[model samples]
Target chain A: MSGRTDTINELVRTPPTSFVDSLARARVRDRLVDGVAASVGDLPSGALVEVTLASIRRARSHPEALGQSEEPFAWKPVFVRRSLGLAAVRSCAEGRFALPSAAVGPVADQAVEEWERTGQRTFHWEPWFAGLGVGGRAVVLAEAAAWATSLWAAFDWTTLNSQVRIGGMDDLWTCPAPRTVRLKGRSEVRTRLDMVVDGRRIAGSDGGPSALVSVSGGVPSEGWREDLAYLALVAGLRAPDRPVPARVVGLWPDAAEERTVEIDEAALDGAVDRVVATVAMTAAAARSTSDDRPGCTSDSGTLVGSAAA
Target chain B: MAGPVAGPVAGPVAGHVAGPGTSGSTPWSASWQPLAGAALLERLRVTGRPRPAADPVLSSDLRSFLESGLCEVLVEAAGSGLVVTQGRLTRALTCRAHRMDDQSAEHEFTIPLATSALIDVLFRQLVTTGSIDDPMADALDGLSLDAHRAPLVDWMHGLAQAERRELRSEVERQADGLRQRWPALDPSWLPRTQTPLRAVLAGGQIDLSVYVDLVIGRPAADVASVAFVDVRSGARRPGHRDDRHLGALVEALRAPAPPFAVATYYTKTGELDVDPVDSDLLVAAARRCLAGIRAMDSLGRGEEPEGTGSESCTMCAMGLSGEPTPATASIGAISNVAEAILHVAEARVVAPSTQTYAQGQAA
Candidate 1:
């Protein structure tokens, strides 16, 4: 659907149903939990290590580096665009669909007001945004508008499944392997499942499987499947009681590329292996550094690393 | 982005649409009084009629015509297709010799953060936010977002305070002119900035790429509805009237219909030159495009290209000094001033030749 000129409607109309049953999902979760625990068993207690897709990619690219160098992250326009664009898209989805150019400033203002009223520093965005002058803020709005416009144009919203969710809580999995390791996967859209049992629809059934959509920036890579698998693994571990996503679609609008990965037991196993490797890398990085391990702050203020990879 | 697929409409000519004067305040601004954005929109709305939908047959025919012309040129040169961007097209059309040298040049030069580049970035902000505060600071912050410009940013940071102040003043003045002339666009207009357009012709032998500064209106409407605007910071130059290239490219890129109108907004003078799109414009643009491709091919084969020796080519590397004879002093003065400012700023960033630039400024 990326560059084929076909609308996204076709992709979601007759989605392939999930074949992995309740027992299989539970088994996958148990395997992931055990794999993660075993990977970080030797790490000292209370040593918090953050693991994310970016850290995994970094570790893979720089295998020779003993420890990951810590750099204080600043809010660049690109990062701000993604953050504010997500909010604008959410606004469009909830109220009315307007061009991103018009929605970004108002949504940004609303965010600032919300922060001012609550005085809760959930994320660093509010303080950073408040500090910017009008010129800097205008730049943020312009960048975000372009970002949101690309996303809004990528799909025909009126034709998609009715239960589409945009920019909510991303899939998160926190593991207490005696070292308090956290894993995160950022998803842009999720189509909630609509299932009926005995001629009656279930509100939120544990067996139902939703579809996750990740709108990425760069071109799709060879590790796209693994990337989606990691998200599935996090989703599974986050809610071990519920079934994982049925499918994960990664959309790269700039490159006009899209790839879909179906979640199953084998896919979850691959994801578990990826998590074990990431944990091992993080533990090594932690050992190499004498200073305290620094938790990576993502765009959404997650304690784990960024999902930008 | 292509508009929705609709029925084909008959090609209609939009005549002499005028609006409140967006005349330039400069001495040379007297001749060009383009319509403001509001006036252009008003003219389109008042004169627009319910036309037919997008005609697939017409689009296909146009594509075939373009391919045939491009292929004829390719066969003559016996060369494979190469990428031809809008800049290359403009360069080739202005002076084929300059275009040829530019293509073959091995030296990589950095473009200083001049007023033109600053306006280009700030235009996006204006379209999105409908206003601007400090154009200088905003443009710097915007450029910093691009990782590839780290070297340029470093160079900018190392500039003297006085030089930085001069650049900032120029940027602020140009940005102010832009804001005064530019109108606030509605969201329903669906104004998108820096929309990429590509048209592959002759079985991918010729890849034409261009980015429309701003695009509005929904595609695939009952009639031609979309509009394309190209933002310019420098004085209006020759070949700026050929917006038909943009229209031709958009149509060739699978747009259900050609844009209703194409415009060029000069930030220096707050002039918005709008031209309605007609079949003739697209045809002319296609013809010009073919000529450009043939010229590029000729240059590739080491064949000599003709030089216009126009003031636009005064800086041509082919020794086309474009000296200003007494008969063309007025026109030459405008071009010389703009060129001198740009060339000097570029030199300041790439080299240490500030004395000449300072002398030019004093004169």
Candidate 2:
């Protein structure tokens, strides 16, 4: 329990309550804003995804350079299992389908039936399903059942408002900047928390408080907090109206624990700074790779090098 | 599951009568065309003008006929308590007329389940936000994911990089087309999508259900004011008229007042076919529903209805035995794989959440 509390505390600071304390909180928010803006302000617009990809590529290319061991180069495929599992959870929450545990056999059958019928083959698992042996197919279904069961057991879904829309997989927000640079945010579950007035539930708005749920394995050692922050930033920027996410929850189902990051003005600032730093690293790596190319002319190379610098 | 009960024939029963025209080839301009929203309601008002109370003996005879003929089918279909939905009823009626075998019946069931899932997701997004920013991405987003072994996930994982890219591109194109052609529904009309309507029959032994894709106007409003819209994935089928009629039935059963209109929108063709709801239409729909229940009862009793000898009968599973159609092939491949998965899941059955079940009961 202490470990879980520590995890949550790492991301969200206690809110100031008193009038005098509120001013102190505002000052903290302003300082964070200034710091974050300065970091990401210089990058060309619409480069967030490019920069994020570049950072991963760079990390892959020179693991030793970042004090890490190197691994063979392979495309890190998108996790379809996580997406499907989240969807099942959402469907259950929305009462569209009975939870997997109620009838695992039927639930799994229907899920696969839907995937096939819909002609969805974009997932990395598509090929795996095609080549799967009988035993492999069984294993896949077993895993689906287990995953769905775990999600079903995790929360008290009945307490949530009946009108609350449970969205899974497809929540994406994009904010375009100068130079065609854009920042995108993806959340596994974007639950628009319902407002209760006199014990009656009302629909949530774009500006209303939302809880962004991200599914992952165990907490990562590097940039984990920033990762959540980055997600918050994208959600804030992409929000069609006012009031971005009030909090982000990262669920590690394997560990059966979750980390919550409260989004204050300061948190937003921190997220932007992290994005800017990642973009800068990507830009630097791109420049170095071009400089090392044999076909590059020295005069033109310097210009490229100077621009990167 | 007894054989159909033999009884004296009553005067011109409901389902036996010829329904309004549903032929896709015939031009709609040939006769009375479907009326749009407000106009349809106005027509209903005129046609449904209150009449003198009917003879008590006649009303009693009609009720008895409905109970014995229709209730028997519903009770049999709900054997051990199965939910009977509008879709299921529609299938029973269509299959009975076509004399479809068990295989064809199952295939028909699979098609709509799949299509409805896709349409439901899209409709949810539209009603929630009033627009879709990225159709392809949104559709993909609706899929559930997990990190462990899941057939769909595994299949997605196994896709070659190029193949994955190609799939995404195609999805984007289709999504874009859907978004561009999506009807401009006013959000203020209180548009709601995938709304579930349920009514129990045969003393709650059978649950007759229907899900309207997009419903405009509020629940408390006059029934004639609310518009019930059904979204179809492909071009309008001859059976679509039955589906619209079912919509009318759903409205009549659930809402205090009959709906203003019932319509179907074909996603591919971007055509909306609106039918006005009148007392006569409701009666017709009620008769069709009773016929469907009766058919289900016959099937339970191992009695197959005679085929109508329509051209559509050519596609029935009874006559077709050679190479599988594309739909059949795809469904077979997928269902086989899904059946395998279900076998494993069944072996490791987990206890369902009591709270969730209780919540469902509450709903």
Alpha-carbon runs more than 4 Å astray in model 2 = A1-309, B1-65, B71-79, B95-119, B145-174, B220-223, B306-363
Interface RMSD of each: 5.3, 18.8
Tens digit of per-residue lDDT, candidate 2, span A222-242: 445666766766655554354
Fnat per predicted structure, each in turn: 0.31, 0.00
lDDT of 1 by residue, B218-326 (tens): 5542346566778877766546655435444445345556665677777766665655454545545655565556556656667643323343342342355434222
lDDT of 1 by residue, A136-214 (tens): 6776777788778767766666555356777777666777565567888778777755555687664433356677778
Q: Which pairs clash in the backbone of model 1?
A: B6-B54, B7-B53, B7-B54, B8-B53, B8-B54, B8-B55, B81-B205
- The sequence of per-residue lDDT tens digits that candidate 2 reaches over residues B70-168 is 444555555444455665665554433344454565533232333344444555555444355555345434433223324443454466887666555
The CAPRI quality class of candidate 1 comes to: incorrect
**Model 2: DockQ vs. true structure:** 0.02
